[model samples]
Target: MRRFVCDCGSPVYFENDFCINCRSALGYDPLRADLITLADWGGGVFRDLQGNAFRYCSNGEDFGVCNWLRPADSPSQFCKACQFNRTIPDQTRAENKERWLVLERGKKRLFYTLAQLNLPLLSGWADPQRGLLLDFIEDARTSDKYPETFVSTGYLGGVITINAVEADDVARATVQDELGESYRTVLGHLRHESGHYYWSLMNPEPMLLAEFRQVFGDERKNYQAALDAHYQNGPALRWRERFISAYASSHPSEDWAECWGHYLHIYDALDTACSHRLLDRSPESMSMSERLRAWSKVSLMLNELNRSVGRGDAYPFVINEVVAEKLELIDLAMDRLRTLH
Candidate 1:
């Protein structure tokens, strides 16, 4: 979430397509990890001032669902981020198009953070066995067209399926209330589900699995049974003392995903803080304990600012000593995972 500036010295945002100040067209270059102000070279091709040739993602040209750019020499019509999509809502339907647009915005933001982390990313098309992909689908609850379908926002076999209704704020909020959730958003769901994708990539060894069980719980436990119990009986009275969220208490695997999601949330927030000059160092330079200590001061000020504006706390969750230890394990595991290839 770093602040961006247009070439004309005007403030720009990551999602901006046209700069309001200089009337320049903006395009994000996935290779350079930058938003460039484009100059029309000729006949639908564009060039950054540095002479890097590019083209807008096809979705951007056709449906305006993306703002990313791909190298002109590349054979792909989609940008690196869009290449991950295995399916999308029907664009012919106006409502579905609008929902897909909102969903793309969230997906792009998620991709931006993922790129910033320097994690290994590949489209499932490129590596069918283990690469990541996304699918935006709807079910009976969200639409009348499919009365028997039920698609949850989840990751399985390298595919992330996000229920299309999650794009609609009212629908999402209604579900949040129905489920008694304190916080939920399209970005949060993607972040949490992506943890499952990467965890599959990790495929823990015996020692690692043993360590994860000690920190979270027995991941070997029945997932469906645990979820059934969670919804039926609810979390323990002191759940917050251990889990980052009530849902995290449902199963050990979920605990891992929740911790994984928060690990990302913390990184992005600190990255933003550094961008704003409120923090003096990059998150990569800090230890896990240092990050927690820094986040405490950072989150406290953030909560106070939210209170000042009469909004709820910007961050509703806290990391206790136990959670901190779990995060450290996640950090270590990710470091090892990243080095494998």
Candidate 2:
């Protein structure tokens, strides 16, 4: 993420709704990908210093869960990022609002990175044939509404489903431990599931599909059966030699998505490092090989920094030779996906 500052020079954040130093209301302009200090223009409208009129997304105005702005005359109730939300957690429950807030923050961050990459993004509502949708729902784990339903975080059709309970720190940690995961977070889940969405969107042609098979294995393999075998036994032997994570060894598609997610993770982290003057060049200027090389140094420093502060490694997974090859293919695939925009 790029560093942001309030007009008064106080440091702000991507998720900020108000400037601390200037005490000014803030609104994020999705088109510009910038956080701007706003001046109330009256009657639920706001204007920046340049007098561009805007209104808070209905989700923001009503739920305080979003900080994005829409053009005052746009007629859409939601911001560009929020428009993809097909279902939000039921707001009647007191805890659901907080969960929704956390979920929205992750979604906005994911959208920001996707926009930065110049990827095509359309709402399922606008173009159901080739668009994305998000669903934040509750199941037996977090709500009484569904006593037997369990909503897993995943992508299917054109929609990404995230269990709202994943927003709760305790609940997430418990699952993380139960699953023997090294690291997990709301943003991580969003990025990973989005990989699945984009892979489907790509729908690679024969030659490209052949290359995908060469890099990540045959995606035509039985997915559910592979997953069942993986869970019943364990990750394939010597998974670390080829996969980004143990779970990535479950199937070829999972491997592709896992590598895709890591590509985003590395891109964002390297971009942030460059923005903060910790790196000399941005990820955009680097080839896949250069990115992998630079990420090695930066990720090492990141882990050391975390250790200094008494925290565990910020990034626990390693990019091995096989995984690096998969990431390179994913990088190329992203270039093709960008053409759809």
Candidate 3:
């Protein structure tokens, strides 16, 4: 993500609702992809320095879960990011408020990166067949109301359903340990599920399907059986030689999603590098091979920097030769999605 600066010259974060230094209000303008220090014009109306007008999305006004802005003259109450939500966690409870905020923060970051890539993002309400939607739901683990409810974080058809407990650090860490995962987070889940959503959007043509099989294997295999086998018997002994993560070895689709997620990781990291003058060109301007090579060097530096501070690696996995091939297919798939009719 890009570092934002308030008009008062104070550096502001992406999720800030108010500028600490200047005491000005802060909001993100999706049209310009700029986070602005707002000039309040009264009655919920505000404008940026360029005179572009906006107001907080209703989700923000009602629940304080979002910091995104909608066009001042638009009839819609929700911002472009919030429009994709088919269901949000119940907010009657105070704890759900904080959990929803965590979910919204992850959603906004996911939307920002997808928008940055210029991907086609039709809401499920807009295009019933191929559009995307999100649902944040809770299970019995954290809620007394749903004694039998269990919702796994995943993508099916066009909707991505995330288990609400994932927002709580203790709960997430417990599950992460139980599952023996090296890494897990709300943002990672979003990126990974979105990869599945986009793949459906691809609805790959024969030639593309043929190409995908050549790289990621056949996705037509029995998904449930594969997952059952995966959970029952861990990844192959040499899974790391080909897959980005152990869970990815579960199936071809999972592998694709894992590679796709790492592609975004590399894209965002390299973009940040260019913004800071660490690199001469943006990730968009580099070839896939160039990006892989640059990212290898950069990711090493990132991990070393984290170790210097007594923290774990920010990016824990390596991009092996086989994983590099899967990422190449992901770049190609994104190029195809960009040209959809």
Q: Pick the candidate with the highest TM-score.
A: 2
Candidate 2 C-alpha lDDT tens digits along 1-341: 89888888898999999998888999899998999999997898999989999999999999999999999999799999999999999999999999999999999988999999999999999999999999998998887768757779999999999999999999999999988999999999999999999999998888889999988888889999999999899899999998999999999998887888888899999999999999999999999999999999999999999999999999999988888889989988998998888
Best by lDDT: 2
Q: What lDDT, from 0 to 1, does candidate 1 have?
A: 0.88
lDDT, each prediction: 0.88, 0.92, 0.91
TM-score per candidate, in order?
0.96, 0.98, 0.97
TM-score of 2: 0.98
**Residue lDDT tens for model 3, 1-341:** 78789999988988987898889989988888888889999989998888988899999989998889999998889999999999888888889999999999999988889999889998999899889999998889878898756679999989999988999999999998999988899999999999999998888889989988988889999999999999999886799898999999999999999988889889989988888788888998999999999999999999999999999988999798999988998998888988984
The true-versus-predicted C-alpha distance at residue 327 of model 2, in Å, is 0.7
Query: Per-residue alpha-carbon lDDT of model 1 for 224-321, expressed as tens digits?
Result: 99999999998757999999999999998899999998888888898888889989987888998888888998899998999999998889898999
Candidate 3 local distance difference test against the native: 0.91
